[model samples]
Target chain A: MLSKKQARAFFLGGTLVTFLIFIGLTIFSLSKDVDQTNHENITEAVVRGKDLWDHNNCMGCHTLLGEGGYYAPELTKVIDRRGRPYIKAVLMSKVPWQPNGRKMVAYGFTNEQAEDLIAFFDWIDDIDLNGFDRVVSPLAKDKTN
Target chain B: MTLYKGKRRTTTALVLSMGLFFAALLYLPGMLPFDSQVTDSFFRWWVVHLWVEGVWELIMGGILSFLLIKLTGVDREVIEKWLYVIVGLTFLSGVLGTGHHYYYIGVNKIWLIVGGIFSALEPLAFLAMALFAVNMYRKGEKKHPNKLALYWTLGAAIVSFVGAGLLGFAHTLPQTNLYTHGTLVTAMHGHLAFWGAYAMIVLAIISYAMPNMTGRKLYDTGRGRMAFWFSNVGMVGMTVAFGVAGVAQVYMERIMKIEFMKVQEMMEIHFYILIICATLFTTGILMYIADFIKHGQPTDEALIKE
Candidate 1:
């Protein structure tokens, strides 16, 4: 049997070798699958959509991807849930608060700005997000603690 | 024994404080839906800032300094004052800098400016403590075969302070914070700063304390390096992805004026990067756990066979 020091060395060394192999595999796997649909313009449009989210401070009312304020819908996959015109109509709806006590107060937008918002939403809908949905229910953090 | 007694008392208090803070974190999320922007921000500072800067940091510095004193046979008096200074400065600057988190809460711009500048001073204290630890290590050469654990402890100190404190300053200024807050850039900082400060320090303490707790010859050089690489590399991956996604959000929101829902959809792709990094990070933690569980060879004379 090996000494304590020698056995310690063996386990540590074994772990290192395995970790290095894992690292190599991770890099190799990531490089092989470049999705062709991830084009430049579409990518840029997606980027613009994110900027819009932050500037508006949507987290004030809405939850997205399990992060953010919980007063509004989870919006990680809003495109799948709602249609293009529906999204545009909602943004431009001029009706500002359907009254019965919803926490979200709407911002009045011109029809053209609303259309731009729709275009942004449609672009997001087109991107592949690997199947996360935007639904508003209590999150894991809510249910567990 | 008196010195050890004092150290033990301090450590126990620190542990209690940490446990309380974690309990608070577990409870705070439930407070949402009733969560006001300001109230939530208030608790965020209390949980994240106070723990790292105010309490756990002071505790860690004290415990490590005490260990150094014992290990190096240095007079504990000489180290105690320096430890106090480090801990004191960390708490003072950290608490006042709680104002930095106030920017989004509709606090005055002046508080943000002052908090940003004062928070910048935290890293200098870390740098001095790091230098002192290195100098102490250099003084005590070839003392024990297990001296390597001290080096790991020092590395944890350096990187934790750098990732949590130094890089923290990079995006903390008002201009950068404007673009980054509530974005993936903010998420990146949360990941690195918290993991580096909290996780690495815990690992270092485990490496130091486990041998005594288990009564085994517990130091393993190879596994330590593997854990270190996996964590640090995965952190780098997460940080880069977060940065890219943050910049992307900035372009989309400020420049392109895309709607909020659409921006979120675009940001989903960034989750793939985080998922991969999480896998590597989890693997690293598992390997460390394995090393701890199966500690010593059964037949070794140096180990007390259970």
Candidate 2:
């Protein structure tokens, strides 16, 4: 029952407003939850490590910032799960490092390269990811939720 | 007549797109309990899964229905009937199919059952669209002069079936998604679905409407055909590259348990291929835009008289 002009105006305006609000609200909520308090230790080594990770395209096989390939486990908390020395050793060796049944691809990282990536991993570990795997079901006796 | 069609379809699509977007907005605040990454993840999937899989389909349905009615020279009632079927199938499955993203998002274990079963039915809607478009094209006795529009319309329906339906079903089961959810495998499906279902329909509408709007008949030009073929072939090439890289990534990283970065290093060649294909796709879009500009501004006198 609306005129064409009115309809067009309402349609475009409504969509634009809705999209803007959705994005704004999501960003606001995400900002409140960001826990990057570990910024002090984000040195040049960590930056280089991040650069090297992007350069080699590690995300093609691993998850980082929850945005990459999920073939391998998430590297967001990898440093915590596996110690720095363990990660370094795994990188330095060229053999297929089998974390499970799958043989891990070896990239032949030198000690320095390994240390830099480990440092990047170390820096990432300090940020709070809010416990991605903590059980929160009502059925659990001590529900984290 | 053309102005009426553009405003009507644009208005309808905009309304539908906003409706779902707003629904997701209302649903998002409750998901803000950032203490549990599990909780954050549970709600994050709601917005993404609901938009792409749910309401966006309605937008595509509206545009496709309009295009079919115009391009096929079919009676509006006939096209509207099939439109109803498409909308019905889409909502019936798509609303519940959102459960597909629920598996392992820290929701209740009930999701494992519901998500798997419902998502299995999702491809039916896309298949219906493919059949519907092809049938309409066949039934229309008179050939529409705009061959490029016809090509894109048919391409939208058929390719969407392969990308959003068959390719989507390739790894949609809970069992497969458990392994392929965030991997490059998902990327392959995502790229094709967006291109085929959404992007193609957009191009189809533009192709159909542009000449009519500007009082120009440029459909037979080689550039128009080149744009269509180049973009379509480029997109298919990109999908294949993503697919090949994804399969190898799953094997190397998940099955072979290669260190993640090493597997990525091995797969860098595929990314190069993706870039090259993307460039080709961009070039085709630029060519299409060039034709669009050459058509000149629309004047009221330019409107075609029946």
- Using lDDT as the measure, the top candidate is 2
Q: Across residues A73-105, which tens digit of lDDT does each residue of candidate 1 receive?
A: 545446555656666666666676443344355
What DockQ results do all the predictions give, each relative to the true complex? 0.02, 0.08
Worst 10 residues of 1 chain B by lDDT: B33-42
How many pairs of residues collide in model 2?
Answer: 11
Per-residue error for A81 in candidate 1, Å, reads 17
lDDT (10s digit) by residue, model 2, range B1-306? 444467455433543455456565646645554333334454666667766665677678778877887778787666665655665566566655666665544344445565677678879889988998999999987688999999999999999989998898898887676666557888899888999988988989998888876887757778888998888888889999999998997778556656556777899899899999998888888888888887646756566531
i-RMS, each model, one decimal: 17.6, 10.4
Superposed Cα deviation of residue B85, candidate 2 (Å)? 1.4
Query: Please, what are the lDDT tens digits per residue for candidate 2 over residues A67-136?
Result: 4665566766576556778888888888888765556777889888899899887766555433322211
RMSD of each: 18.0, 10.1
Tell me which residue pairs clash in candidate 1. A12-B223, A47-B252, A48-B252, A49-B263, A50-B263, A51-B253, A52-B253
Q: TM-scores for all candidates?
A: 0.60, 0.67
Candidate 1 per-residue lDDT over residues B45-97, each given as its tens digit: 55666566656675567656755765565555555545655554565466556
What candidate 1 keeps of the native contacts, as a fraction, is 0.00
The Cα local distance difference test for each model comes to: 0.57, 0.70
